[model samples]
Target: MSDQTLPKTPRDDDSVLAAEYVLGVLGAEERIALQARIDRDPDFARHVEAWENHLAGLNTAFDEVEPPAHLKDALERRLFTNIDSAPQAGLARIWNSVRFWRAGAFAATAALALLAIVTLREPPSPPATGETLLASLVTEQGNTRFVVLYDSSAQTLRASLVEGDTPAASDYELWFVPAASGGAPISLGLIGGEGEKAPHVPANLQGDFTDGATIAISLEPAGGSATGSPTGPVVAAAPVKKI
Candidate 1:
């Protein structure tokens, strides 16, 4: 896209630029660039907030309808069919999807409102060791399945499933892989299909959060890995990055 097509220059005269942003019309690159300005400019942030508040009213205009909690299986069968996960669908790819952006202004406003509601319900995480780090547990298909956030400020580790369906007869186990050349996987505990979890970081394991730490997820038995070590197929793993 042309650089001029994006709202790089946010000004009072171009206040509608905030509206376009709130409507999710900007591409990922454009969004990131505009976000940088929003972070540094207090007035611009307020301008964006005003747009969000104005757009949020659209959510109330229509009757609130909750989507079925477990629609992954059905949705995939219908949409994906013979396609194997439909490529990587990375942020950039999704941003460029015509069907996605074609949802237009009202649909985008509703989505933003829904996100706001979800964010409001998120409980605050306990402070960790003052340094923050995170790892995205991704599948071999290049899809991010879960995100593990290490809250050094709260001395806690939180994991949230970003994609994939919860197993009907099994559980997803979290594992920590040390940065050493040949480190064995250590079981952190089981995580749910959706939502966030603050798994118990054993006192012994607490000190093991190294700069090169990696997090892994495996499909395990109902409760968790029967053995202390991972005993199931490891589906995803990735090194943690500093926030």
Candidate 2:
């Protein structure tokens, strides 16, 4: 039997394009191309259907509002009154045009999609009661390495490695710097290699874990920083914010 390979499925980029099409945000040429694909390609048609279904729920949140009393009159004047010379043919032609309905649907769908995106992007509400502080530590290259959370009640600092490449033969030392400009960086402790760690926050330093404080991780020798102060290069740092 002759060896043959099936076509690869469309990537995430295609899904995004399909979503844009269903949202009516694609430009004229792009929309035309996608519409052609939807008509001929079953996979592309499914992608469009999926996006439509996913976004359909958002429509329920929008309550219908009645248009202004003069709006209908204005539309009639603008579209029909201008065709006084050939009133019958012109009015019928404009009324039968698919472009008019398509434009209205496009505008409505685009507005709904925009609202949904803005709503989704909003940050979640903070907890009701907590002396919790959180920070997202990232390297100089802007790559997130860890998510750090400090709980004042428990006097504990939790560090979760999200994404990063650890240096071989070196350890990561945690440090806390107070918000004050003259305050020095105090070493918290050496972070473990495991993906999750909850190190006890020193009682004396617990008071310093306030908002605007800075938490950092420095790459040090296996034994950790030699001089109490950070002697090695700082790998990631983030400012603590109260929740």
Candidate 3:
């Protein structure tokens, strides 16, 4: 807290601070303070924008992941080894170098989420007779007029929309979210908001149709998301449960 103005010194730490912010490695207090600085300082704001642009391409590229067991310790050793509890002047040094404790912040932010991850057990397979699975897709307002039934043997869901409005030039896309943590959602093509339309599950996703997996309805363009992930608002969703 020695110098809030240190980041405004020059583009050296300023640009690195921008990268740290975009990477989301700052603490809650630091983030709020830095964001305020960006709002008032146009030059610093440009640095944030530049870093955002540099990291934008990574959004659709990197998949969700769990860090390795040694990741936390390794990052701590590399980044926090030189940090000290020196006088207030030393606090300025630590504050000025934003990247120094970035790994710590990143680790702190993710540890709770990582600890909350439930171990994914291999879900029981559906019987060959095809267990009937039902999911009532509802909007945020708790509208449940959209229902989908899954046929385990067929690897398809019969979607029947009793009520829902579809925007012109938009299609309702079905996605399969696996039970395992960090798994990406897999698109199961499109479904119509009308009587009994069977949406085919891709061969890869078909195996993951066990209970605990979830099915969601997202509104997309006429064709679908250009990116492999959901790019639009999720209108309704429900967990696939065997009846």
Check candidate 2 and list the clashing pairs.
Answer: none
lDDT (CA) for every model shown? 0.61, 0.63, 0.62
Clashing pairs in 3: none
lDDT of 1 by residue, 98-138 (tens): 33222322232444456557856888556544776665554
After superposing candidate 1 on the true structure, give the runs of residues whose Cα lies further than 4 Å from its correct spot: 1-129, 142-144, 193-198
The lDDT ranking, best first, is 2, 3, 1
Candidate 2, 1-243: lDDT as tens digits: 748964455667677778999999879998898889998988878888999999999999999899999999886444322121211221111121333324433333444456557857988656545577766655544332555667887676766545444455556677886677888788777665333322446678776678767677777786677788888766666566664
Model 1 residue 56 CA deviation (Å) reads 22
Model 1 error, position 230 (Å): 1.1
**RMSD to the hidden true structure, all candidates:** 14.3, 25.5, 21.1
lDDT of 2: 0.63
User: What tens digits encode model 3's per-residue C-alpha lDDT throughout 1-243?
Assistant: 675555455677889988999899889999999989998999999999999999899899878799898999886444322222222221111121233223323332343234334312436545468766666554544332455667887665666554444455666677887777888778776665223323666676767787646777777786777797888776665566655
Report lDDT (Cα) of residue 223, candidate 1: 72
Q: How well does candidate 3 score on lDDT at residue 182?
A: 88
- Local error of candidate 3 at 160, Å? 2.6
Cα lDDT of candidate 3 equals 0.62
